[model samples]
Target chain A: MTTSKSNFSKPLILVTNDDGIDAKGINELIKMIDSLGEILVVAPDSPRSGQSSAISSGYPLRLIPVEKKEDFTSFKTNGTPVDCIKLALNFLCDRRPDLLVSGINHGSNAGVSVVYSGTMGAAIEGAIVGIPSAGFSLCSHNPDANFSACSDIVTFTCRKLLEQGLPQSVCLNINIPASDKINGVKVCRQAHGYWTEEYDRRTDPYGKDYFWLTGQFINLEPDNEETDEWALAHNYISVVPTTYDQSAIKYIDTTRNLFSE
Target chain B: MTTSKSNFSKPLILVTNDDGIDAKGINELIKMIDSLGEILVVAPDSPRSGQSSAISSGYPLRLIPVEKKEDFTSFKTNGTPVDCIKLALNFLCDRRPDLLVSGINHGSNAGVSVVYSGTMGAAIEGAIVGIPSAGFSLCSHNPDANFSACSDIVTFTCRKLLEQGLPQSVCLNINIPASDKINGVKVCRQAHGYWTEEYDRRTDPYGKDYFWLTGQFINLEPDNEETDEWALAHNYISVVPTTYDQSAIKYIDTTRNLFSE
Candidate 1:
């Protein structure tokens, strides 16, 4: 219950996610950061899956208070994970949090899925807005997955990140394996892997057409030991520093070499 | 009209973007890709701004064919740019193209916006399904951006990449300057930059509340020549090999060091 700190001395940590307030992953994550710093929790009101880094344009979203535990304050919003971070920054927070943490996501964002992950999307948004941010995920996709192993790792990693300081506008993508017995850690590259999209065709009860999103993940870079896929396979937790600059600079010269003459 | 490749057995390129089909930027990109390969076009029907990687969920996304000249078999999708790429891959492509190129986006995806970039997101999705994919973007947000100097660089870099091949699963993030001149290419990192959210509040015509998302981008890392920000600032095309792996392995020991007894 000791929440008071010399206002400037205690780093304020803002926590939010694509998974809504009640997800076990978030609950365990809250408990970890709760013991670390001055805490504020702003999360989506419902499971906003595959939301990517989307923000709302349809209507202005409103925030509602979630229960406050000892040392933690919680609020839920009807916005995307990106909105939660923005709302906390522009309205809810009294001052800027020194740190922003997202997810403890239900599944891995270790490969192509990072583009569709709301967890990392929010964290990336935080980093874009000058908040040192991060996104964490377990390697399991199960809704009620066990997060006990994730709890220990969250504290150690986020603390060190706070201590060491990350590269600017760069947030960490942390994916822990489901088994508690982890091998080690690797600063790995992303594997060449992607989902083969297969939409399920179905007829709704209203006699209308519907297509459900489903896909099987296939790793094209199986032999590549330096990638996140390799690390996760050996039970090593993977960390890849991700960012937003999407320019193909290497190919630029090669491309120019063809026509530049 | 000759549809046959007489003087060239160059690769066939499929170019598209989130910017509307008629965008000057896309037009410039098409000219560059056309020089290197036999090019085709498929893109969003209109601007899918901030749409992220959204695919159709409400209904079957109807695609209407876009009327264009020869050497261009085009279509406009009722979904995001990711949808356009999907349709190109599964339905439209006569055969698997040698490469799939996206964007020449009107703005920068420099820090955290990459995940939500319909341009980069499409290429990311393409890379997943076993195609060598890349997204090109100009740092300028102007609709009438003069993309003249960039053409030589784009052709050079993309041609090289298509020749040597990108490291598996790792695509190029190529960012060009808004300036008229150019510096050479720099293999740099993504700059540490972020947006501090400032939502523009307004009342709709129906007296309903609405908000337009707005924010200023702040770059925290300027002195680093190794970053895309510095490269673009110096009038160089910044190239960073970015991947989908968002793990934080560097912190496993850091976390373990902090928490484990």
Candidate 2:
């Protein structure tokens, strides 16, 4: 594995989240990582839940400077999570960031949820751009969820990533189980799970129709102990090394056979 | 592998796209697949480029039935690609769809581009819902890009998928090289690649700053023969089996050791 070029005494850390610039989750994350480096916070201007890896191409993005201090600086954008990373790298940051830390997001981005996570998307984008990155999510979806219990693990994991670096093109999806007391940490694979969707149909004053999106998660492999879902359910913080490559290498041969004439 | 529960003589197929309901690409796809089964088209109301796997959670969604006929039905929604699938599966469809097909997308969804594609998101959502699914893209950005050469491959592959069910939670990402004449097909891996991003920064007359996102693709492994980018470059229709499990299993032990005390 190639060593990352993050050798400076004070690393440049880019921070972001999907829950908007003013959310409690991002604020908790800033409190944890602020002392470690020169921090630049570039995040979305409003809540962008389930944004995945979206980039806003239909409109021009505006980056508004929010705050600036000796050890910290902040900006917000009228864009998605991926757009924050792109805007920060291209226009906000004077140089490439050494570390990218996203979230302390309100909800768990474990298992299949990562695919719809704006928090994880920012960190993935950072890894794509050759930065060592990690996304932290508390398992609670409540906006006011307390993150004090997660502080120690967050610090430990972030420091380790800054020190050891990561495999090229890989980032960490760190999910902390929601609690007031700490448990241990676990390195696990993303669990096989899916959302069973239920749409609430409604009508407008003019008798036109609409729908609301709601769902429940069903864990396909409930007995599997090596999955992020299991780890989180057992009250352990789960860290899954994730890659952007979606290729199912094991299924290639069979797929080729089926498609061949 | 479990056989899908789509045992009827005629299959029920769900069609959607990221390029909005009236785009030429989706229309061509509807034309290609309309005869294979009872088809239902549910897509975004406006262009949703770079939407990835995003879902709408903050606002209520609306699915408006636009066209209904003997062989086909269509709806346009004010939501992202994934929202279209969720709404269709939950309230729109009479029963679970036998298959889900998204896009003859206006641009290529090859290599790293897949991570930012709204086209693939709908297919992934379908696979999550236990349906055989595929996302098709033509390697051209023009709205009116000719898809005549792509129709044959689209028909062949979609038929094969409907005949032989996909592995659980796995879907196909198919990209056709832009050409008048076609080469054969290739089952390939997602190529190692990244975008070299450059933001075009601009200022308004009021001196407010805004930026436009633009980038060029950089292939990391140009000589690798088993990759989607290479297949496309050589005029082969590329089919990559894509799964939602982002875990880099090979790196699990090393990651565990790093965080271990």
Candidate 3:
């Protein structure tokens, strides 16, 4: 294993994804940004979708080295997305990473899906450690989905982030529409929406009932152009600056009043 | 199974927790609020800590009914805390819950831990469904922790929430100190903090290395009186109004300027 020694010459970039180290999305992302910096990849060994900020406890984690090259190294762990970030930051990285990027996820992490996204969870973990971080996703869930359309946008966004640091405690959730012809990018707010969960019930061989989780996204404000959902629907790449601190500051006083009596 | 028909005669309260169906903290929580409304519990069958807003998608889930009474019914699911909430709201509940409460957690879910809390995840799910919700946590992690001191506070908070509805998409994260005599209650903001992860590495009999996840919280703003950490340290019950919408709205303009070039 390479020692985590500081090399102040070039920027060290930490790359990861929730879709595991072998996914096409992450491979495309690594190739697109190879010129940006020295790369260190630590990701889950298998797809860990919908695991938002979940960390594995009560069990020991194993990190296996997958590949090693000059200026690039890769390892896969038997852990969740957030666990990958923790392992990379705390044990693996050669130094404090200059920038941390997660995903070119297999599906959309737009709207309220951010809360249930392992992609965003890794980025949020990076932000917590004071790293400039961002998560990227395509609207399509196809295993062999074309990510070429997202290459330039991803590179540009990362370049800008490297040039200009993001505010502390903030990370970006970038969702690109699944289109051959792209629209421009827009910085927008997280749209108010939810999954209308419909469980597909079936009986097992033992005559026991089981359910498969399925849902459709319901946009509460479909016409609001300021929302990420609206931006994505109009074929624009949506970027929402998200924070780990979820305090609703505007309602503090109201809550205080409710408790005072 | 009960039908999901609205019964507006009495308030229907949905109760849940991250620490399985049999944890002492949850039992204490359910007992304290029995008089407020009709209670229906849908929780995980086993302890599911640190599962923040995670949902199970690729696998089938099983919900097992454990107990049934006149005004209270309980079911345990083989899923994450957020999944339990989804199942209750969409499949199990006899009606829309007027109020939702998660935990009197064995450990504190204050400060940045809120982002990783399954307790808070369930409450956030409740808030997303427009129900008044709150998650309660004591500062202890002991399996048989004394919870008598938290009884009055839990009852009072639920009563107030039932009386005055929380704003849409907002929920409370109430963390009590371990002290038996609480100083009082303080409504505060989520504190700035991060866990300093220390992985305990060990060599297995097969000559492979593994790591156990462990950490200490490093509070960034230790002196900030407005933060949740400070409130908890002063022996007060910290009530932070948390929102699931994590957009950092103040950074939108700056982010837009970065992309404008």
* Top-TM-score candidate index: 3
TM-score of chain A of each: 0.91, 0.94, 0.96
Q: What is the lDDT of residue A157 in candidate 1?
A: 74
| Interface alpha-carbon RMSD, every candidate | 4.7, 1.1, 0.9
lDDT of model 2 at residue B37? Answer: 86
Give lDDT tens digits, candidate 2, residues B1-261: 111224367788889999999899999998898789878788999999899999898899877768545446777889999998887777667777888999989989999999999999999888887899999999998988999978998899888888898998789999998897667899999998788765777889998878888888999988898999999899999999999889989899889988996
lDDT of 3 by residue, B112-157 (tens): 9999999999999988889999999999999899988789889998
Residue pairs with clashing backbones, model 3? none
Instruction: Please provide, for model 1 over B10-95, each residue's C-alpha lDDT reduced to its tens digit, 9 standing for 90 to 100.
Output: 67677778887878888888877776776768888888766576555435654566777656667676667877776666555656
lDDT of 1 by residue, A1-261 (tens): 112233566778889888788887888788877767888888999887667777775467766777665556787888888888877777667777778899889888887677778888888787666667888999987988988878766887778767766654467777899997998776666676666655554666876544455667787777788777788888988776765544444444453443334
Candidate 2 stretches greater than 4 Å from native: A1-8, A68-70, B1-9, B68-70
Interface RMSD, model 1, angstroms = 4.7
- Which consecutive 10 residues in model 1 chain A have the weakest lDDT in total? A1-10
Q: Cα lDDT of all candidates, in order?
A: 0.72, 0.87, 0.90
| TM-score between model 1 and native | 0.75
Off by over 4 Å in 3: A1-8, A68-71, B3-8, B68-71
**Candidate order (lDDT):** 3, 2, 1
